[model samples]
Target: MSVLVVGASAAGLSTVESLRRKGYREPITVLGAEWHLPYDRPPLSKQFLCGDWDEDRTRLRPDTMLSALEAEFVLGDSAVGLDVERRTVHTASGRELQADAVVIATGLRARVLPDQGGLDGVHVLRTLDDAAALRKDLLEASRVVVVGDGVLGAEIAATARKMGLSVTMAGPQAAPLQSQFGPVVAGLLEELHASEGVHLKLGTAVTGLTDEDGRVTGVRLETGEVLPADVVVVALGAVPATDWLADSGLRLDNGVVCDARCRAAEGIYAAGDVARWQHEDSLLRLENRTNATEQAACVAANILGDAQPYRPVPYFWTDQFATKIQVHGRPSEAAEVTVAEGNLDERRFVVHYRRDRRVVAVLGWNMPKQTRLHRHHLVHA
Candidate 1:
């Protein structure tokens, strides 16, 4: 049996490794558009941008690790099409590979401001190349403007502030991460950034970008105000890289829809940001590393006839401005949230999301023990 994986990021690499660990020993091949090995992306905007880590340190697995698994690595090549019926993947390099099972872990790509004329100092943090370019500019930039108030944008702004740059965040929302954490918690985040000397231009829209000689100079807001920006980073979230599978006959909504077993179609499976699975009669997709690894393991086990469903609790972590935030399980809108430990003013606390007096999720800041305790409750609740 031969297994083909379309991506070589966390999801793809984890799936391949898990399958090998299960003693399948099939002819596994991993395809990636990037030449670099699978690497952790969370550091791209934090340690890596701050010059605290190098590429070698960010890599998920060393060369020896891939070699030990006997998996073929096809770097700098993209999977352009999939023959679902025949179980073949057509690559952009004019190679068609046969497979017994295929895993589409194409993940996601950063959303770019295309109409902004692709200014030299404007970038999106997604790939290693994007990080490298932004890092170079960040080292010398005095003023930085970040578009979007999502987790990625917030992290970038925090890092820029730490680097002594005058950071300005512009987003349509009232506060950073308001949609995810609600207005109250997001207001706290806004206050946190404000205390760090970062300017917040919330509930605003960008009209266009100002450039001089192809270099970004500032951003023009819809309010007719121009903000000076030596560097601009757009973190408007990501879109799944599933355009290649358009004609593959697989159901695609926000992502490739899959069953509880991670099965997209016969002889095909998907995990990671590209896979949307049925969860409690609702379709859900996660864009976190932890979910990718867990789902991949579940898919591997099911592929080997384990017959187990993929239903692990979602978990994610982010480090920004020296604050370590960890989230376990999915927090629904109707969940009753309460501060379980520490104080938000102290920047150390755990927020528990409860439903029917049972904890369903927890968010912690520098409180691992409390987070773990609530995580256990979430798992068994």
Candidate 2:
């Protein structure tokens, strides 16, 4: 059967690779909006932004490996519409591709502030091109302000500080990743950033941007104070890229709603950040890199008649300065956190989050092996 995947990122690539590995020798086509080949995105705010890794180094795979897949690579064109019944995808370049089975993996678009558009020196880090532009401005910029306290924003602030620029982080959360890691762990993270020379402007909302002569000068806060900056990077998070499927007759909420099998329709399936599929008794959509490939494998299996449900333990990781943090399962701010291993004061520890005596998540701060071992508790619980 012919298959068409409407994204060329890790999710789309993983589906195709899984199908081939499972001995499905049918024709496959991978469509991508960016002109560049599929690349890793985790390094965009770290290695790529800090000029440690080049564009070529970020590539997911080399030409020789991709050529072995024997799939048509359609790059630099974006999908404008999809015909659900006909299983056809309409592209911006007027190319209509029909396949027996279709997979949606469009991923997400970076969120921006109200006045962020058309403002010079304001940036967002999502794609490779975004990293290149932000890095270029950062090299010449003496002061930089990051407008978010989430993973991306914290990472950007760390990278900029390491690059010797005066950096500041602004967000409504009390600390970086407070919502995800809770007050205790997030408090430690705040201390780490503060010690590294990054200014903390937390627990306050950013009102708007101040610009003079079409160039951004500073970020205005809700309290009427302005954080001066030569460059500003907005890391407020992202939303699913499903505007093109607005009229595709598919259920769209936070993402493309799907069944436990990840099937949105008769022959239409979805995976990765754009898919909100059922997991046990709840609807879940994960935006991390691990879920992309894991969910794609599940989709490929079901497409080949495996008929297994997709239930994965959510995973995500981030690197800042000399720290590498890895998390498994869902950790909420409301959950009770307990240190399961090591010592938090030493900056190498593993913490477990629990609700009603049931462990909900595990986190590792500079302790990868022990953290992974603790994840088994989540699986067995």
Candidate 3:
């Protein structure tokens, strides 16, 4: 029996590697939509965009190392359809491959702004090519307006400022990262960005774009104000790449709905950003990089009928302007945040997020060990 993984990034690659390591010698095939080998994406907005690291540095594993997985690599070929009834996969390149088991890790595609035509100098970072083009634009750009206040937007805004470009960030929230870090921490982040010379426009929505001769000149705000910019980066989040599974009947909602084991159907499973599995009284779908690897590993075992539930604490981190914010567990549901270690004035502290007087999550600001230590409290909670 062969296993087929749809996606060539961390989750797909992890599934392949885990299966091989588990003594499964069955044939495995990985299908990638991108033309290049699978590379790490976290660096695209940081070291890679800053020119501190090259493309090779973003590789999760060397080509030679991945080649040793003994699986067929179908790079540049996208899986357009899945025939779950016939156990067949259809590719855009006209290849009809049969598989005994199927794994969907299609990940996500960047969300584009409404009514924005393909204007030059307007960019979104997701793929290597996206970063390459944005990097080129950043080096020559004098002023940039970044739309969105999420992790991607904040990171790009920080990177652009570090690149010596004047950056003005338009956030729909009162403070950037308010949804993820809450008001207290988010207010601090807003202040940090201000101190670093990043202009912030809070509670403002981007109305449209100002284009001149097929190039975006600036971004128009809902307030009828325009921020002149040589380039604009849309860091708005993303949607799951589940359009191909529309006819597959795999129960698609925000993503591919799956059981606790990451199983979508008989002999079919999903991992990474595309899988929303049942978790602790709710359906949790994490877009975190660590979740991708962990969920893929669980899916690999569950594919072999191990029956292990894919229960993860949901961990993620972000680095901005030398400040590292690490978080573990479900902080979104927390009603209170307490300083577990260190003081807030130091900007290097660990805070515990509590829900109903119980520790639900932990966040560390430049305190890695403390964050990890508190993560243990929620392991069996």
126-178: candidate 3 lDDT, tens digit per residue: 98989999999989899999999989999998999999999999979889888
- TM-score per prediction, in order, is 0.96, 0.99, 0.98
Residue 70 error, candidate 2, Å: 0.8
Give the residue spans of candidate 3 off by over 4 A: none
Mind giving the per-residue lDDT tens digits that candidate 1 earns over 1-381?
788988999999999889988898778999998999899898988989988899888999888987998999999999999999998999999999888899999999888776665578998999988899999998888999999998999999999998889999999888988877766567778888898888999899877789999899998889999999999998999998899999999998989999988899998999899999888788989999898899989888887888787888889887778677888987654677789889988888999877889888898988877787778777778
TM-score for candidate 3: 0.98
Which pairs of residues clash in candidate 1, taking residues 3 or more apart in a chain or in different chains?
none
Best by TM-score: 2
Which has the better TM-score: candidate 2, or candidate 3?
Answer: 2
The digit string of per-residue lDDT tens for model 2 on 1-381 reads: 899999999999999899999999989999999998999899999999999999999999899999988889899999999999999999999999999999999999999999989999999998999999999999999999999999999999999999999999999999999999999999999999999999999999999999999999999999999999999999999999999999999999999999999999999999999999998998899999999999999999998988989989999999999999999999999999999999999999999999989999999999999999999989998
Count: clashes, candidate 1: 0
Q: What is the lDDT for 247 in model 1?
A: 95
lDDT of each: 0.88, 0.96, 0.89
Q: Against the true structure, candidate 2 has what lDDT?
A: 0.96
The residue pairs found clashing in candidate 2 are none
Number of backbone-clashing residue pairs for each candidate, in the order shown: 0, 0, 0
Q: How displaced is residue 145 in candidate 2, in Å?
A: 0.4
